[model samples]
Target: MDPNSSKRHLINQLSPEDLKARLANESFKRTTVSFYKYVILDKPEEMRDQLFLIWNKLHCYGRIYVAKEGINAQMSVPDHFWNEFKEQLYAIPEFNNVPFKIAVEDDGQSFLKLQIKVRQQIVADGLKPEEYDVTNVGQHLNAQQWNNAMDDGAIVVDMRNHYESEIGRFANALLPDAETFKEELPEVVEKLKGKEDEKILLYCTGGVRCEKTSAYLKHHGFSDVNQLLGGIIDYNRQVETEALENKFIGKNFVFDNRLGERISDDVISHCHQCGSACDTHTNCANKRCNVLFIQCDSCRAKYNACCGDDCQTYVLAPADEKESLEQRLVFKRGKRFYKTDKSA
Candidate 1:
């Protein structure tokens, strides 16, 4: 790696306090927030540069993306500076009050730096622009309301990937056994082809996927489709507002160091090995196939963080020798062996 890239990568790994202080005595305490807007952007690179300059000044830290289709953002800025963040977001014609979802748990270390990248799709669905009408989305519902709709025989489908749904979902939500975001979207739609007018509830980690997904369903003739307003994040938020019981159970898996956040007293997902109902998600400790995934405490120890015995040796291998061993393993088995489930 180039020295500059390596150094930048190292900086992004700093601790929360160190990162806060290292940003050079900024004037506010950061409140972490996240949201995505899936609208067409004319100039992705220009959009990326423009947001970077504006956000870097606010000491914002998290990830954001811009594409020909739209934008997705997960960021932290000073609590006092939230207005500034909001203003900057709304200044762009497309992002006005665009419903961003908050994470269920607040970790001081959720993000270390601000990053903006330009991509082809905000969330890669591998579909052409004309595949589905992206404008007409489903009905929106708050936590309490969504739960009520579920009671009325709504086909509550977990709108996240299988692993994500495995950890947390609405009670009895039909999980699509899907391994990817794009696949699950169509799968969920196909599964409910004839049930267009029935109450349909959809949800995901931060609710952005459903923005386009709900639109797709609406285009496909699904009438009474609805989604959790802010997804799990907003669900947790309203859980406090109405003092409603947490209808969703277990831990909400996240894409950061803090892993999963608590939503209720119930524990749903079990340790893949020991079967203890823990919601913590961890990557396989094996360096070669370090799949970003979920595992519980007991399983963490049992696998020594590797997820399986094949990975165990790789995790224990000396750093200098690890590369050659990885090459050899790959040369012998190809990518199929790497795809084997190591989800403990």
Candidate 2:
């Protein structure tokens, strides 16, 4: 590591309040957007290093992962800095605006610090590039366009992972069962094969994965494939600006601290146990195992912010004893067959 570089530690994440205050003081307004491209990169290490240096200087902040498979990013860039950011990115032929998708809700501190890292696969679904045509991709559509097509009986599919889709999705969107990105790609194509000539609309968190995924489907002879132009983020912005009719209902799931952005103001997701209309996705409070699950505000308060009674007990104990208990209950995600604690 370079001697001039800042120290790095997993536990040393920046505080959200601190970041928000700094950006506000700077009068920095940022545009939240993202995009992806699946192409074989000859020098991932060199690319990662260069990207980190460039983005950091621009005061850009967001999560970005690059692999030999492709590059995926979800970031917030200062509004005044957008021109230079786009110029520097397009300077690399592999990425040109690449038709990026802007986030719907803008939080000054969407990400803490600039982090560019190399990985095996950008989205972490272990599938080889040879399995599908990552280069060709699918058609792009906006919220208005996607909604109209659905009115015509088109088959709309949510291209995001299970956790993302569970919180906010198009009312009638076909959600894939796969927990990862790679598995869902081929599965969605196969499921829509019968409707090769029919209008097949696809969407995702920020519209990055669907870009290449759509191209892959077209390469396989899917006659008609359309994607949400800016994903759910851009769709939300359009709804607010144009006073357009809202087609997508419920909270639009986000990966950042804000958790979710409510589009239609309807509580679609329920508290895992109480069956109340709540749309919050939370991490399990079990100290030993950090499994992710959902719970409403009421349930969250009653359970003392834990997922279940067992988690409540574990959390209530002293730190050392809790650690000991965690070591004991440390088995395979043992609660897979269990239901969300409703008794709280």
Summarize candidate 2's per-residue lDDT along 1-344 as a digit string, tens digits: 78535534312256867776766687768887777776777888778777777887788888888888668887888899899999999898777647676766677666766677799877765555665576556777777777788889988889987777777788788999876687798888788877778888888877776776776677677878788887888887777787778887788877765667777777677777678777787766664445556787888888787767767777788977876777654322424312433423
Question: How many Å off is the CA of 121 in candidate 2?
Answer: 3.3
lDDT against the true structure, each candidate: 0.73, 0.74
TM-score (all chains, Cα) for each model: 0.84, 0.82
Compute the lDDT of residue 9 as modeled in candidate 1: 34
Q: Report the lDDT of model 2 for residue 6.
A: 51
**TM-score: model 1 vs. ground truth:** 0.84
lDDT of 2 at 47: 82
- After superposition of all CA atoms, the RMSD between model 2 and the true structure is 3.9
